[model samples]
Target: MRIATTILVMLATTLPAAAAGQAADHRVLPFTPSGQGDPQAVVCRAPQKLENAEGYGPEICLRNGIWILLTQDAKDLAADGRSVFKRPLVEEPHGNGPAEAVTCRKPPTITASRTWRGPVVCLENRVWASLYERGLTVTGDGRLVSTRMSGPATDPTGMPVIQTTPPPRDAPVIGGYYSPL
Candidate 1:
């Protein structure tokens, strides 16, 4: 009973001290109403209207360093939503040879995987990309090879067409015979 009492006493004493130490050690970052980071610092300027925001929006007051970061983030977010064709050409084509050589009826998906996301358009180079997609074609074994190809395509509810002999990788592309695979 004495040993149990001693352990309980020790725990009771240590718990409050540990909690106090934790509270004191906490490093709280100062967020002042004034544009300046320091709480004691005087307000340098009034809050400015957010220019990038459409229609009327709330004004925000932040330090110069914070403002620059927010502006850059806004610009990047805007560019991300736009199609690759609309933007300047920076990324190289997925396949060999010039991207210009590959004729496209509609804009290519322009992503990591051609059959991953976005609209799948017929390209001279990657004709198989349009094929093997969900609505267009399934494998001979009745497996979904690609599910991401979407747009004006073949009947999704139509009967499955099986290919007995699949063509080689170097076979002539289907959509347009611009060049040999």
Candidate 2:
């Protein structure tokens, strides 16, 4: 009986250890969404669910840094009670270079609107309007100035779209892939 008891105790202790060893052997191998194996690789994670959605929405691959920015933006949007249509106001310096140097142009519909009270620069074929001209407006004079406290960036769901870590440069695109600029 004493031998049997000692055997039972030893079995209880070693059984789990043996089982764990076996489990570790079958551990999930690290692989990118592209099916490439890299132990040190940062694979894109799942995007955040908005407004208590049941599902995770979709599996999109984005850089971890971008994900961080998006997450912060989402949190800020939530706190500001602003609509997703509104974008956060970021301060930008007045360009001393030619107006044509700016690649993008503000849409005419936005510029023609009555609410558009900001400085509107009319390019040859494009109209450039400063969207960040919310709240208190001040001339930079080549210096940074504080702008309005606009809401944070948000997705259509009025929440920040959380993204996962970025994959290797050579990883093939799978599902919804976002390329960082």
Candidate 3:
């Protein structure tokens, strides 16, 4: 009886550890979405508008280093190549330069944003109205990033989007892939 009890206790602890170890082995599988990875596939707003640009006429919010390629269509984020950008991008100074290229990778994913950093220039096409106004923004357009907060602030949505980590270990990270945001 004493030996059986000890075995049961050991099984409870070692069993979980063994299972977790097996899970780690299969964790490296690349996460693939259901389509030809396209940035325009994501159709939604960042919720927090960091900067605004007036292209053509209407106002466009540059969120998470991405500019609102189409004010009417949030999913369609285009680089301001044809002088489409109207705001003072943090990347270009003086606001007058050729439309730079943005090395677009995978598809546009969605994640639970951690914090807001105002406005910033993460892409080249999102360069200043031209190529003269390049810099970073201090606002967050409701993008996703994993960060550790120190103080007690609040999400504009009155919800907890940013947190310690993502949903689960196997959850597909949103808003791009590695490196958080």
Better of 2 and 3 by TM-score: 2
Tens digit of per-residue lDDT, candidate 3, span 1-181:
4453344334323433434434433222111111122433321221222246544221222222222232211123223211222232332233233344232222222346653233332333333333323323212443443333333344553343445555568886643232465
User: lDDT of each model, Cα atoms only?
Assistant: 0.30, 0.32, 0.31
TM-scores for all candidates: the values are 0.14, 0.17, 0.14
User: Which sections of candidate 1 miss by over 4 Å?
Assistant: 1-55, 74-181
Candidate 2: which stretches are off by over 4 Å?
1-45, 63-181
What residue pairs clash in candidate 1, if any at all? none
Q: For model 3, where is the 10-residue window of minimal lDDT?
A: 27-36
Candidate 1 per-residue lDDT over residues 1-181, each given as its tens digit: 4454344334323433444434333322121121123432221112223356644321222233432222222211111111112112212223333321232222234344344322322232233334523234333233335444334332465434334455678987343223344
Count of clashing residue pairs in every prediction: 0, 1, 27
Prediction RMSDs, each to the true structure? 22.6, 28.3, 28.6
Candidate number achieving the greatest TM-score relative to the actual structure = 2
Error of 1 at 166 (Å): 65
Cα lDDT of model 3 overall? Answer: 0.31
C-alpha RMSD between model 1 and the true structure: 22.6
